[model samples]
Target: MSSILSGTPIVYFECRQCKCVLQNPTPDVLDEWKKEHQGHTVTETRKYPLFDLGYNDLKKAGELAQIANELGAVIADIRFMPHTRNPEFSLKHLQEVLGDKYIHVGELGNANYKGTGGIQLANTEAGMRILHGLLANSAVIIICACWKRSECHRVYVAKEYEKRYNVDSTPITRTSARDLLSSVEEKNNPQLALW
Candidate 1:
């Protein structure tokens, strides 16, 4: 039997006859490999992207857009009350800034956001279904106002998505997002750094 393992930092290709290794194989590459290999089975090990971002981390909607663009993901605002003191993080502003890439999944949000009540599954199943539909096309980055994942309802939502979808989720921190953004900027504007 032959198989192609993907959806991780690295992708691996193994066959009963021989082993071929490729790093970060794109969709085109995977397609070409399949055509050439013929009869080989393909198994994707890569989990869908389930990111948790706090507005406190990246204050600007443009910054959030950059991160989402880089990940090729839709921004899922998982806050029951999407309004925030910061105008940039407000629901209206986010919808404007993100345009088509933004969505408010209030169903996944915690109804008792102010109190001690935990995740309400009543609407969660519906919300998860919505997210499931989205995941079929692109990755999703769940966002909230809380600075820490442990201190936010997004943690529970992330867990639910992982369990329901049978895929691992990555948490995007401020530092990590900044680093990726920096790399992207450098790639785009190499001449700017020369000065």
Candidate 2:
């Protein structure tokens, strides 16, 4: 049918809150969030450390992260496709779980997961608040879309944080989750994805 042929690519949006992608988020809602807040700053994008992992499959998480960490990854994107199952886990929860163990990895940019989230965050005061909290805790977000680009970009958070607070940020890269779990004695297990 002509309708099917004319459809735009459906980019999934992972809720920074739930960790699950907001599938096909409506543009009206996206626009509303952007309009609610004004005078927000956007930043240049830097390449994030990425790995190829299928996000839809929760089953292989252990296997993927375990092996990847064993190999030399500090963070793992074990999933590429954001599914409903990923749940809406906020960046705050992640900070609690990872604590200091969560080494900075991934790109330094904004959340581009939904492909609309970045635009949304620019508008929503609530979104900005959450981002500020994550930055306060020194959260290093990692979102992999296709292994080459970040589905969820948040480098802006890092750089903006630096500029606002007059702090210097050291971003890290990650090939897999294995790098995070490995110790100094582990062979081939790279540490501090950054220099």
Top model by TM-score, which number? 1
- Evaluate candidate 1 by giving its C-alpha RMSD to the native, one decimal: 6.6
Model 2 accuracy (lDDT, Cα): 0.35
lDDT of 2 by residue, 1-195 (tens): 111111122334333433333345479865664454334432222222222332232233443344333333333221223233344322333344434433323223223445643522333344434444443332323333332233433344444545654545443333223233343224344553333
lDDT of each: 0.76, 0.35
lDDT of 1 by residue, 63-110 (tens): 899888877888989899888789999999999999999999999888
Alpha-carbon runs more than 4 Å astray in model 1: 1-47, 192-195
Clashes of each: 1, 34
- Each model's TM-score, in the order given? 0.76, 0.31
Clashing pairs in 1: 7-46
**N/CA/C clash count, model 1:** 1
Off by over 4 Å in 2: 1-124, 135-146, 149-152, 175-178, 184-195
